[model samples]
Each structure stands twice: as structure tokens, then as C-alpha cells.
Target chain A: MIASARSWVDIYLTEMRIAIQQQLQYRVANYFYMIGMIAEPVIYLVVWTTVAEQQGGAVGGLDSGELAAYYIVWTLVRNMNIVFTPFGWENRIREGTFSGELLRPMHPIHYDLGYFAGWKVVVILLWLPLAAVLSLLFHPTATITPLGVVTFAIAIWGAYLIRSLNQSSLGMVTFWTTRVGPVFDIYFTAELLLSGRLVPMSLMPDWVQQIAWLLPFQWTFGFPIEALVGGLSPEQLLGGLAMQALWIAIGAVVLRRMFSIAVRRYSAVGG
Target chain B: MRAISLFLTFLRVGALNELQYRANLAIQLLESGISVFTGLVVLALVFSQVPALNGWSQPELLAVLGVYTLVGGVIGMLIQPNMERLITDVRQGTLDYILTKPDDSQVLVSVREIRIWRVVDVILGFVIIGVALVQLQGTLGPLDAVAFVVALLLGSAMVYCFWLLLTTAAFWIVRMDEIVELFMGLYASGRWPVTIYPDWLRFGLTFLVPVAFAVTIPAEALTGRLTPELLAGAAAFALALLLVTRWFWRVGLRRYAGASA
Candidate 1:
């Protein structure tokens, strides 16, 4: 079993290297993508900072400094958790390349995860210095404790797993329908509101905050960042981590079933 | 007259093509509604704390949001679809068919593809603006109304020219769709008043991506905050960009044809 696990790791590392090389060839596109990744957070940061200032320095228990910290962390968490699969899934299925994925001994999700890991390494290498510069300009304040740091690290990986697996499931839905684009639009809208991508969930309407707690979206991006920014209690962190694990497990099961069904359909249809 | 007729014909074709999939209209409305709802929710969350944002009250900011949505819809409906089609056509060498057409190729390319369901955003935008205007009826004057219309028209024109210029770059860059995404990233900053941003960011939004002209100036006109000098500047910028993009489009076409030959 240990040897098998080592071989799987070896395969993923090789795939990661190849994916990194492929992504680097499109380095210009990567830079443009970097602009987009940073822009949305920066825009919201300015808006929230303005609000905090106008309200006499604090809104919803967060000062301008805290809001800055929240949004910057939000940016990093988003980069870590985002999956690019849903965007290209339709094209792949329609163009018949999905059959190639089906023919492989390994599941396609592993390849996607490897590619995602590679792409994020590139993004972090580019994004961190820029984030540091932004932190200097924005003056974000985070009360980073050892506990918060440890929880954040674990929660972030869980967030990545939850997001990637959930999106892979969504992408697999393209096997049956071409309307996955609209599905993504709806998903993004929900994430923007419920996941605290646009605002601190604590500042959201009470009902929304309640609903967000039950949903996986917050666990994927919001909870980790909010925890790191030092608002959540130990109980809350434990609950959030439990929820993330549950969602990740659910997502993996759902995606595995979806891949089996989709591949069967593909073969039946002579794909 | 011919150009208008051709545009109308293309619109009809697009509408008919989409009519086959009636479900898409519903989906489009749902997505657009969700985005609009999310925007309003964010605005409410911010305003729940503060009474005003940079001297603009919630109602005034609502008007700005309305302008942002309306402009975004128009771009998505008209400019973006056509530009995206042009990029794809350029890539697939299908642009040759557009060039061989009897009418002007530029006009054909600009009106080629339309997502008619985006009219929902345009209508929603108007409704929001109307509601906001009624709330602030006492403050607005006729000049403000006229300026709003003028700014909206000029803003749409500038955005079209800007997008066309970006699409024109497809002649040189194979993967220039990122340029459109870059445009959107900058344009997202237009969700707020431009003056509130830092000096450098403000300048970049104003001249680099022209988001100020496309969104903020129109909102400013409605709020009676638009200066005559700024209006003049926007008008001059629109006219200049129109001329420059037309010339640029011709250059791109020449390069495309030469390379193909």
C-alpha cells in the first residue's frame, strides 16, 4: 500500500511538472489572468474601506484595517481554491478529448488536481509579492495567532478540495447538457453572496449569514479567511473544519459516480 | 440606411436562432437577475453601515449601479458578442467570408452576433434608474436628464470603440480575449465613483481602460455632478477614439489580408 501510494505521488508530480511547463508557455495569458484575479478583490476592498471610514472607522466589528486584511486574505483563499475545469469542460466533451481522459488508468480528476496545483504554484509565485505591495499600500491588519495559523492551513487545503471536487462534479454535468455555462453563472452569483467573496459574512443580512453556515460555499472560501483574520472561535473553527471535510467527502463520491456514468454514456454514444 | 437595415436583419437572425432554445432566455434572465441581486445585496451591506459613500447617498449610488448594469448589458448584447465572434472568425479564418461580403466588412463584423436575451439587463437597468430617480425627483433637473442621455450615448460609443480596438489586436495576437477580460477587471472598479479611488487608479480607469467615461460619467450626469469640462472631455475622447479605432481596424484588416495572401 505504501509503495502504491508512492507511485501515485510520483505520477502526480510528473504530471504537475508537465502542466507547469504547458502553463508557462502561455505566460502572457497568465499575467492577464493575474490582473483579473486581483482586480475584483481590490475593487471591493476600496468600497468596503470607504464604508468603514464613512461609518466612523468600524462597520460590523471590522475597521478599515480589518476589512483590508479580510479582502486580501479573501484574494489568496480564492486563488488557492479556484478550479478552472468548469470553464473548459463543455469544449472538451464536445471536441471528443474527454475520451482520452476516460481511456487513462487514472481518473481525470487527479490530472486536473495536478494541473490545478501547478497553475496555483505559478500564481502564488507571481501573486505574493504583489500582495505584499498591496498590503503596504492598504495597511491590512491581521491578528495572526498560532492556533489561527494552524487552522487556516488545514482549512485552506480542505477549501481547495471542496472547491475542485464540487466544480469537477459541475463540469461533469456537461456530459448531459450544454447549459453548464449558465449553471456556472448561477454558482458564481451564489458564491459571491453566500461565500463572503464580496463581503464579510458577518456583515451580511442575518438570514444570509444563517444560510451561509449551512452551505458548502462558505466553507470553501469564506470560513478559512475569516478564521485567519481572527474572528472565529475555536468551536467555530472545529465546526467549519468538520463541515469542509464532510463536503469534500460528499463531492468526491458524487464526482466519482458522475465520471462512471459519463464515461459509460460516452462509450455508448461511440465517443 | 443600409447599415441599419443590415443590423436589423442580423438582429432578427440572432433572435430567431435563439428562439429555438426558449429555455436559454429563462436561464439568461436567472443569471442576470442573480448578478443584479448580488450587486444590490453588496450595496445594501455597505450602506447598512454608512449613510453615504463619498458624498453620494444610497439612492444616488443605486443610480450609478443602474448605469453600470445598463452599460454592461449593452456591451454584452452588442459589443462583446460581435467582438468575440470577430476574434473567433479571425482565428478560424472565417473572417474571409465577412470580408468578401458586398457591404462594408467592418460594419458586418460589428453587427454579426447578438445575444438578444441581454435586453433583460437593459430593462432591469432602466427600472432601477427610474426607481432611483423617483426617490430623488426633487434634486434632478432637466439639464441633468439631457446630460444623462448624452453621456450614456457617448459612453456606449467610447466603449464600443475601445472594445473594437482590443478585438482588432487579434490580427497580431492570437489569444487576445484576455484583453476583454482585462477590460472587465478594470471596468469592475466602475461599480464605485471614480474620484474615490487613489489618484493613480483613478487615472488608469479614466484613460487606460476608459471605464470612467463608460460608467462614472453617465452616473455623474444623472446625479448633477458632471462638470461641463468633463462632459466636453468625454465627448472629445469619444470622437477621437472612434476615429482612431476605425483607422486601426483598417490597418488590422490590411495586415490580416496580406498575411493570408
Candidate 2:
């Protein structure tokens, strides 16, 4: 068990290093992708700010500056939400790549987890300048506390784990059907509405906020953004991390069960 | 005349090829339906907070969303598929095949591929517009209908030119997939009126990307917000962009080395 634990750390580090190198080489493409994503939050910021200005500088209890803060941090959280897509799984299974992956000593999910975690290092690095630019343009006011900051840092990684587990589980659906677009699209639509990706959940209707509370989506986007944008209190800040941990635990169990079943269906024809 | 024939021929072929996958139509319908649902939900969220968003009512914004869907559908069906192929052909040097064709390479490349199922969004867009027009207090006048059509055509032309110009850059920039991501992100901004955006972003959407022309202008025409000056300016800008794209395509072509080279 001790030896296996050591090996797992070694494997993860090696995989993450490889990912960092590979992602660095594709930095220009990554930057283009990041720039593209920036538009979403900026558009939201502009619209909400305009709305706030119209409604006596506040709407849904958030001022224009707070809205700016919410959306500016949104760019980072959105990047965190990026995962190995189900479409990728469809391609992997169809192209026979999954066969090669299955032959490896490790489970394929670990590969995605470690590699994307390293890519997150690159993503965060690339995000700084973009965030600076957004800060300059939008003037986001973050009263981020030390405790809040700590919670946010941990919650983001927890968010990453929960999302990766869920998405990989979803990706397993491709084993059954290649036409996963409809399924994936429905999931994305749900995530968009429930997650703070579209708008802060607080701004949503009371029932919508209640729905978001029950789901894992908010722990990924809303909680993380709210953490840094200084929305959560001390208890809520810590509570959000606990919620993320609960979701991660649930997600792992679900993914493990689904993967076990799904792998049986994978005939691995491409190899 | 030759270009028209070439476009129609390819359109038919593309439609027939895609027709075999009838399930995709359902998928496309669900996709567009989901999007329209979210669009309305966002509108509801906004309107629930305030009666109007910076002067535009909920129905007017729906008109914008309708036009956005229509223009997005047209681009997906016609422009994007071709432009994406152009990017791949550039990288692989397969553009030589299209270049050697007797027809103009630009016209040939522009019309070769169409995702016929994207018509789902076009029809859905018209439905939304119909619903919005019904909800709206004032009826759309005949003159406004003509103006809306004109603006929509010009807007589509501008979008086509914008796409062609971006695809043309593939000759210089080797990796171009991000261009699509970038376009989609910017194009999504058209869901709201350009007028509502900060001036810098509005300028970016209008001149940098021409999304303002694609969605907002047509919505404006329908909502009785179109000024003659604005429509005329859009016409001139579209013409100018077309000429610039044509010129840029030639310049980019000069850089193409083809596979044999």
C-alpha cells in the first residue's frame, strides 16, 4: 500500500509535467481560446452594469462594481470548468485511442485528471494578464478576506475534481452512443443556468437559487467566484469547501461505478 | 450566374448527404430549442429586475434574440462549415485542389459545404420573431419589413465577409480553430443590442467583428429603431468589407505554397 501510494504520486507528477510542457508549446492557441472566453464575462458585466446603472446603481442587491467583481472572477472560474469533454471521449473511442489508454497501467481518468491539473497551472498563468486587463477595464472591487482567499483556493481545486469526475462519467456515455451532442448539450444548458457561469445564483429567482443549492454546479462556479469576490461569510466560505468535498466524494463513487459498467461495453476496436 | 449554379449544386449535394442522418435534425432542433429556452430565461431574469433593459423592452430583446438565432443559423448552415474547411485545406495544402478549379476559388470555397440541419435554427428564429411581434404592442409596418429584409441581407453579407477574412488568415496563421471559438464568443454578444454595451466593446462588435450588423441591425429594423442613416452606413460598410475580403483573399492566396511546393 505504501509503495502503491508513492507510485501514484510519481505517476501524477510525471503526467502533470508532461501536460505542462505540451500545453506550453500550444500557448498561442490556449491564449486565443482564453481571449475568446473573456468575451462571455465581459458581455455579462456590461449588461448587468448597465442594468444596475438603470436601477439606481443596484439590481438584485449587487452594485455595478460588485457585478464587475463577480464577472471578472467569472473568467477564472469558467476556465476551471473546462474539462476533457464527452466529445473527446467519442473521438477517443471511435479513433481507437481509448484502447491504447486502457492498455496503460493506470485508469484513464487519472491521466485526464493529472494532465488537466497541470494545464490548469498554464491556464492560471495565462489568466493573470487577462484578469489584469479586465480589472483595468471594469474596475472590479474585491474585498477578498484571507480566510475567503484560502477557501477559494481550495474550493477551486475541489471544483476541478468534482467537474472532472462528473464530465468523465458523462463521457462514459459515449461508450453507448456516439451521438452524445444532445446529452452533452442538455447537461451544459443545465450547468449554465444553475452554475454562476450565466449569472450569479443570488440574482436568479428564489426557487432557482434553491435548485442551485441542491446541485454541484454552484460549488464549481458560483462558490468559487463568490469566495474571491467576497460574497460568502466565514461560515459559508468554509461550508462551500465542505460541500465541494461532499460532491467530490459523490462524484468519484458515481464515476467509478459508471466507468466499471461502461468499460465492459468498450470493445476497443480502434487498436 | 456560374457562381449561383455552383452554390445551388453544392447546396443540394450537401443537403442530400446530410439527409441520411435524419436523427441529427432532432438533435439540432433540441439544441436550438434549449438555446432559445436559455435566451428567454435570461431575458426573464433581466426583465424581472427591471421593466426594460436600457430602453429595450423584453419583447424587443426577444426580437434581437430571434434575429441572432436566424443569423447564427445562416452562418452555421452556409458560412462556417465552408470557412472551417478552408482553414483545414490551407494547413494541409489541399486548397490547391480548389484553386485549380475553373471557377473562382473564393466562390467555390465559399459554397462547397453546408450543414443543412442548421435550418432548424432559421425556422426556430422565425417562430421567435413571430411570437415577439405578437407580444409587441405595435404591428410591424410594410416599410419596416422591407427595411428589415434589406438589413438582414446586408448583415449576412457582412458576416460572410468577416468569416472569409478570418479564414483567409489561415494562410498566414497555421492554427486557426481558435478563430471559430473567438467568433462564437463575440457573436454571442449580439444577443443584446450593441447599443447597451460599453463604447469600446460596441466598437469591437461593430467594426472589429461586424456582429452588430449580423444581429442588432435587423432587430433594430423590425423594432422600428432603424434610421435611414444607419441602414445606408451599413450598406456602405458591407460593400467595403466585401471588397476588402476579396482583396485579402488574393493577398493570402499569394502566400499559399500548396502541397507540392
Candidate 3:
């Protein structure tokens, strides 16, 4: 088992290296894409900072600097949790590429997970410079306590798993529907509203906040940002971690079942 | 006269192709409705926290939303689909067919694809604007209504010219989807007043992309904030861009044909 695990790790690293090199060839375009991502968060930060300043130095417990901190952390957490798996699955299903994957020795999910991890590593590295620029401009104010740091580390992994599994499941549904583009659109809209990407979940309406807390969206982005910047209580941090674990387990089970069903359906259709 | 006939021919073809998938109309409406609902909800959430956004009250913002939906619909219906098709044709060497046509190739390429379902967005935009007007308890007089229509026409012209210029660049650069994505990113900012953005972003929207004229100017007209200078400026810019893009399209076509030959 240990030897097999070592081999898998080696394979993953090799894939990561190849992906990184492939991305490096388009380094200029990737730089602009990173700029675009960073621009959205910065735009919101400036807007909220202006609002907070206009409201006499605080809006929803966030001063201008605090708002900056929140948004910068929000940008990092969002980058960390970014899952390119949905597009992968969607394109593969559309182009009948999944049949080729099914013929491979390994489960398709393993290759997808590896690809996701590889792409994320590249994204995070690309984001580092932008994050630094934002930090210099905004002077984000956040205390990274030891506990908060540890929770953030764990939360990053948990967020990745939840996001990857959930989006993959959505992608798997393409086996049944041709118009799954709308499904992805709805998913994106929901995430924009609920994931604290557009605004802080705490600042949204009471009902929206309540709904956001019940779903995995907040755990994917909001909780980690809050924990890193606002410093969550021990109980809250533990609870968030627990919820993230729960969602990951649920997502894993759903993904497994959906994959099996989709494969069966694909085979039945002679794909 | 020739352009009109060509446009009509393209329209007929587009309609016939789209009519075959009648169910798509319902699906398109559903997708557009969900998008409009999300826009309203986001506006509602933002305004719930603050009564006004940059001197524009909720009703005024709603008018802005209406303008956004309308302009987005116009782009989706005609400009985006054609530009996308133009890009694919350029890539696949099929734009030669358009070039060989008896009429102007640019005109043919620009009107070849139409998404008929996007009329829903335009209709919904009018409905939302009407609702916002009722909420404000304000009457749009003849002059204001005419100004609004004029601004809307100018905005549409400006957007079309801008799209033409962008797609023309695809003749030289193969991967122009990034440019489209950049436009979408900037277009989202049109949901609010341009004045709300910082000076740099405001300039980028106005001069760089002209999204300011596309959505905000028409909303300004509806909200009785239209200035004569801004109106004249939009008209002049639109006409200028239309001429410039025509020239640019010709230049691009020459380059494309030269490269292929």
C-alpha cells in the first residue's frame, strides 16, 4: 500500500510539472487573466471602503482598512478554492472525450483531481504577485493568530475538496442533459450571491446570511476569509471545519454515485 | 438600400434557423429571467444596506438595471452572435465565402447570425423601466422620451461599432475571446453609475470601452439627468466610431487576404 501511494504521488507530481510547463508557455495571457481576477476584488474593495468612509469610518464592523483586509483575504481564499474541474468535465462530456478517459486504467476522478490540483498550484503562484500589489495598495489589517492560521490551512484543503466534488457532480450531469450550461450559470449566480464573493455574507440580508450558512458556499470562501481576517472563535472555527468535513463526505458520496450512473448511462448509449 | 436588403436576407435565414428550435425561446426566457432576477436581487441587497448609491436612489438604479438588460440584449441578439461567428469563420478560412459575396463582406459578416430569443431581454428591460418610472411617480415628457430614444440609438450604434472594431482585430489576432471576456468584465460594472467608479475606471469605461454610453447614458436620460453636452458627445462619438470601424474592417480584410494569399 505504501509503495502504491508513493507511485501515485510521483505520478501526481509529474502531471503537475507538465501542467506548469504548459501554462508557462502562455504566461503572458495568464498574467492578464490574473490581473482581471484581482481587479474585481479590488474594485469591490474600493467601493466598500468608500461606503465605509462615507458612513463615518465603519460599515458592518469593517473600517476601510478592515474592509481592505477582508477583501484581500477574500481574494486569496477565492483563488485557493478555485475549481477548474467543472469546465473540464463539461467539455469532455460534450466532445465525447470521457469515453477515452473511461478506457484508461485509473478512475477518471483521480486524473481530474490531479489536474485540478496542478492548475490550482499554478493559479496560486500566479496570484501571489497580485496579492502583494493589493496588500501594498490597501494596507489590509488582519491579525493572523496561530489558531487562525492552522484553521485556515485545514479550511483550504476542505474548501478545495468540497468545491471540486460539488462542481464535478454538476459537470457529471452533462451525461443526461445537453443544456447543462444553464445549470452552470445558476450555480455561478448562486455562488456569487452566497459564497461571499460579491459581498460579505454577514453584510447580506438576514435570510441570505441564514441560507448561505446552511450551504457549502460559505465554507468554501466566507469562513476562511473570516477566520483569517476577523479571527473566529474556537468554537466557530471548529464548527466550520466540521461542516466542511461533512460537506466533503456528502459531496464525495454524491460524486461517486453520479459517476457510476453517468458511466452506466454512457455505456447504455454506446458512447 | 443594398445593405438593408442584405441585412433582411440574413435576418430571414437567422429566423428560419432559430424557428426550428422553438423550445429554445422558452429556455432563453427562463435563463434571461433568472439573470434579471439575480441583478434585481443584488441591487436590492446593496440598497438595503445603503439607501442610495452615489446620488442615485434605488429607483434610478433600477432604471440603470433596465438599461443594462436592454443593451445586453441588443448585443446578444445581433452583435455578439455575429462577432463570434465572424471569429470562427476567420479561424476556419471560411470568411472567404463572405468576402466573395457581391455585397460588402463586412456588412454580410456582421449581420449573419442572430439570436432571436434575446428579444426577451429587450422586452423585459422596457417592463422594468416602466416599473421604475411608476415607482418614481414621474412622467417622462415628450422631450425626455425623445432624448431617451436618441441616447438609446446612439448607444446601440456605439456598441455595434465597438464590437466590429474588436472582431476586426480577430483577423490579425487569432485568440480574441479574451477581448470579449474583458468586455464582459467591464460591462458588469455598467450596472451602477459610472460616477461611482474611481476616475481611472470611469475613464476606462467611457473612452476605452464606451460601456458608459451604452447603459449609463440611457439610464441618465430616463432619470432626467441627461445633459445636452453628453447627448451630443455620445452622438458624435458613435458616428466617429462607425466611420473608424468601417475603415479598420477594410484594412483588416486586406491583411487577412494578403496573409492567406
Candidate 2 stretches with Cα past 4 Å from truth are none
Q: Which of the numbered candidates is closest to the native, going by highest lDDT?
A: 2
* Residue-wise C-alpha lDDT for candidate 2, range B1-261, written one tens digit per residue: 999999999999999999999999999989999999999888988888889998999989999999999999999999999999999999988888998888899999999999999999999999999989999978899999999999999999999999899888888887888889988988999999999988888898999899999999999999999999999999999999999999999999999998752
- What is residue A71's positional error in candidate 3, in angstroms? 2.7
The list of candidate 1 runs beyond 4 A from truth reads A94-96, A145-154, A180-182, A231-242, A261-271, B1-5, B100-105, B139-142, B251-261
Candidate 1 local lDDT, B1-261, one digit each (tens): 998999999999999998898887888888778878877887888777777888989888888889998999998898899998888888778798888879998899998799988988899888888888888775778888889889999999988888888889889777766777777887788788888887888888888778889889999988878998989989999999989998999999887843351
Error of 3 at B155 (Å): 1.8
Considering the two chains of model 3, state its CAPRI-style docking category: acceptable
Task: State the lDDT of candidate 3 residue by residue for B57-147, as single tens digits.
Answer: 8899899899899989998998889988887788778887877778878778878899988999999999999989999899898999999
What total of clashing residue pairs does each candidate reach?
0, 0, 0
Ranking of predictions according to DockQ: 2, 1, 3
* Per-candidate DockQ vs. reference: 0.60, 0.77, 0.34
User: Which regions of candidate 3 fall more than 4 Å away from where they truly are?
Assistant: A35-39, A85-90, A132-139, A146-154, A233-239, A267-271, B254-261
Ranking by TM-score: 2, 3, 1
- lDDT of candidate 1 at residue A178, scale 0 to 100: 58
lDDT of 3 by residue, A52-143 (tens): 76678877778888888888877768767777556677677777767788888777776666776777777778778877887887788876
Residue-level lDDT tens digits of model 2 in A1-271: 9999999999889889998999898877788789888988888888888888988898888898899899988898889888888888999988878888988998899988999999999999999999898889888776888888888898888888999999999999999988889899999999999998888887888998998899999999999989988567998988888899999999999999999999999886545
Per-residue error (Å), model 3, residue A191: 2.5
